[model samples]
Target: MGSEKIRRWESGALAHAATDPFGPGPVPWLRGSELHFDDTGHVVPWYVSPAAPPGPRPATSPATTPRPTAGGPRSADDVHRQIKGFASTGAVTPGEAIDFHITVDPPQRFGVDIYRIGHYGGDGAGRITTSPRLSGIVQPAPLTADRTVSCHHWWLSWRLRVPSYWNIGAYVAVLTTDDGHRSHIPFTVRDDHPADLLLLLPDITWQAYNLYPEDGRTGASLHHAWDENGRLLGEADAATTVSFDRPYAGPGLPLHVGHAYDFIRWAERYGYDLAYADARDLHAGRIDPTRYRGLVFPGHDEYWSTSMRRAVDVAREQGTSLVFLSANTMYWQVELAPSPSGVPNRLLTCRKRRGPGRSALWREADRPEQEVLGIQYAGRVPEARPLVVRNADHWLWEATGAHEGDELEGLVAGEADRYFPRAALPEHQGRILLSHSPYRDAQGAVRYQETSLYRAHSGALVFAAGTFAWSPALDRPGHVDPRVQRATANLLDRICKRD
Candidate 1:
């Protein structure tokens, strides 16, 4: 920005900051905020004056019991008896430490092994960090009413401090016991630097969909259709609310790994200058979007906070480009509250459809996500379909000799998006539809989904892939499309050159 423009922007920001009673620090949780059950049977937010801290960790204890009676370390049937665990924080920067809480069927000595995830080889790649096997006593964290959403601090099994030399990327800690039972806990080592690209992981979406509880069959999540008890909800029956203070389920594969990692592995293979941050960073206003040429969202970034939305909008206004390599981006609104575990931004609260914390479709708020993403979630695609190039001449299709009539195999699958209606669009933006795929909506009516690009009046460029499968198709063998890879390269090359 020119000196005059920079000065004006800084002045305006300062004035805005001064008016915020919390100053420029991380926005503290509203004092005395608690979930109050009302006569309407809704869990509502009732803010009161300052109250005592919930504590540094959840106030519950793991049900410590000896290892399960079932035995057979080498037996395939015993797989279900393995241990499950998760870390307190999802992603942490080097030099910081994280706590791990575990639940063991048969309480035994467990070990924590950390590995950095990447495309190291065809055999698979994840280099073990120098952090030795972190051993601790494991116990069962039984599922009861008081401890459904959040797990007891239980035992702080292991606190691993990331060394400064650890590379910035996704890391998973493997928790194994002497009995041959194992599970995974994932975390990311983040770096703070000016880079060509900033990768924002959808931690919010991960926690919302995570159904990791002792009795997994009935655990809650933003996607689950039941309440804490086993009763089903009527509408989006999925738990409108969820917390991040518990472990994620399923072999520790962080919420369907194929979507996000496919893009990250491919990007890393080419050595793109990349920095990392969880979506919470955007909410906390910790990222200076102008410092990076582009911000990339990999996959399933469904839930978002108002602050995160504002941050991205501001960044785009300042000329920072954005690439949503996934569909269903910024669909629902949510709020962040301090975890009863005392971790800020750890509790994701969204009272979907009703109540004070009701998370209506962003469009209903007159803040349609499509205004920023050019394409909004239309509906789900019943099956995989070909993505027909609508604009062969667009710069994004520079290589691979794709023609307007050509269809990239299965590039449009799962959920997809289409351009928002005229009344829902923001001002001074020009859109270029790239690909269009037809699918059946929930109503059984034929609908078309569109992939698009738009340049804001401020000259910032935005690209939307218009499908959730775009990232997964990048490197997954059966789904990998060379055309998709080339198109992605074109986008990244242009953005990097702009820097």
Candidate 2:
């Protein structure tokens, strides 16, 4: 956009193009938006112009902690930057491509006032200028559902021109509904860089949750992860960034940008290579597993799609390492049913199966494709009690520069009540890095604890903190252990630099 566009400032945003980004157009106004950089005028999406310099990040804090903890480093894919990969529902290559759709729960009333979608990046403490990548007026479309299904839903697709040069990263289609509702779906842009990964996900074996169903153990979905009743109430609006103010219910529908943000902070505190892929983009060949030395599962990566599993396996076989720092890893099976907005019924919950009389909220199709891949939760109990660190000398320990009294970060990221014994550990022979001792749940009931290890394969490196979705909670100030951070960073470095 050159002289054709003008920037406008609203109550909280700097909008470009005097008009709404999504103007009145036909269904799927699928055309690339004309794009030219403000500084160079040479439009390209290859590298974040100015490029990133090596070394530690600048000292700073995000302007707001919206939820908890303090300033932390932000991931490049931290829901910020301009949205990419939503253009074609299929594989895409470099070229001038335009707009992508934001799938929402209920279709939003179209218009442009101040709709917020995806990660809204603002100036943080580093004195870094606000990232100027993503900010546009959203154009609304008619309320409709997937052509295949007759569900009452909505989707908002905005046009974006892929600069002559584009690179790989997690991107999504976010919808800021008219009623102020919002949801994020996955999308991807091809990597211009040749494959840097060495780990062969396919070559290695996939493991189920740490504490799988051990014969007769019990497990819980860990669904009600609330400190109190008050925590469970809230509503999310794609039209706005600030949520957690309204009253609402639980699971699958609730939104928490803060949770994403919190993980980023913990990521910064612990020095994690900021990486993320929208829950929606795992498939559609969005995650080019070959480009990375390793892939990391964000905590609470409970949702899984066929493409996601396949992507991970390929990376592992290629000698790329994988760090599943999440509990409930691929606990549910889901698919992207075309939506005008927020991804709905993507989880394929039991409720959908009953068609009416169904009672269970979760479903079989909801579980990760572990059975076929070689790993699946062994028990029905999804919940895990607070566990005591059991194994202290496992190889993942090389990451912990700690003494006997030292503590490693702990998270409830994993929720295994019991696990199946492997006929074999890693081929090279692996050991349990850690275990939960004296583990008990919120009700003070004893639950089975799980163990973690560095799998026995050239590409298979397993590091599990055995925590729930909010593992960062354990990484706060005095509660956070440097050993955890160091261990995590070391793992990332090893993977990224694998020869």
TM-score result, candidate 1: 0.79
Give the runs in model 1 whose Cα sits over 4 Å from its true position.
1-81, 122-124, 130-148, 214-218, 225-237, 356-359
lDDT of every model, 2 decimals: 0.65, 0.33
lDDT per residue as tens, model 1, 1-499: 3432222111112111111111111001111223333323333322221123421212122211112322311210112435676687777888998888776655566666566655654212354543444454545443434224666556777788888888887766766576755456767778776789988888888777665541323456665544555443343555655767666654444454446667777888877888888888788877777788889998778889999998888888888899999888898888888866567887787777866643467877878888888879887876777888898998888876899978887777777899866736655567799987776766789888789888888877899999867786676645678888988888888889833
Number of colliding residue pairs in each model: 5, 67
Candidate 2 lDDT at 316 equals: 60
Candidate 2 Cα outliers beyond 4 Å, as residue runs: 1-158, 162-276, 336-387, 399-410, 413-418, 422-428, 456-458, 469-479
Candidate 2 lDDT over residue span 384-431, tens digit each: 234344544544446465444343333332354223354223343344
TM-score of 2: 0.50
TM-score per candidate, chains pooled: 0.79, 0.50
- Model 2, residue 370: distance off in Å is 7.3
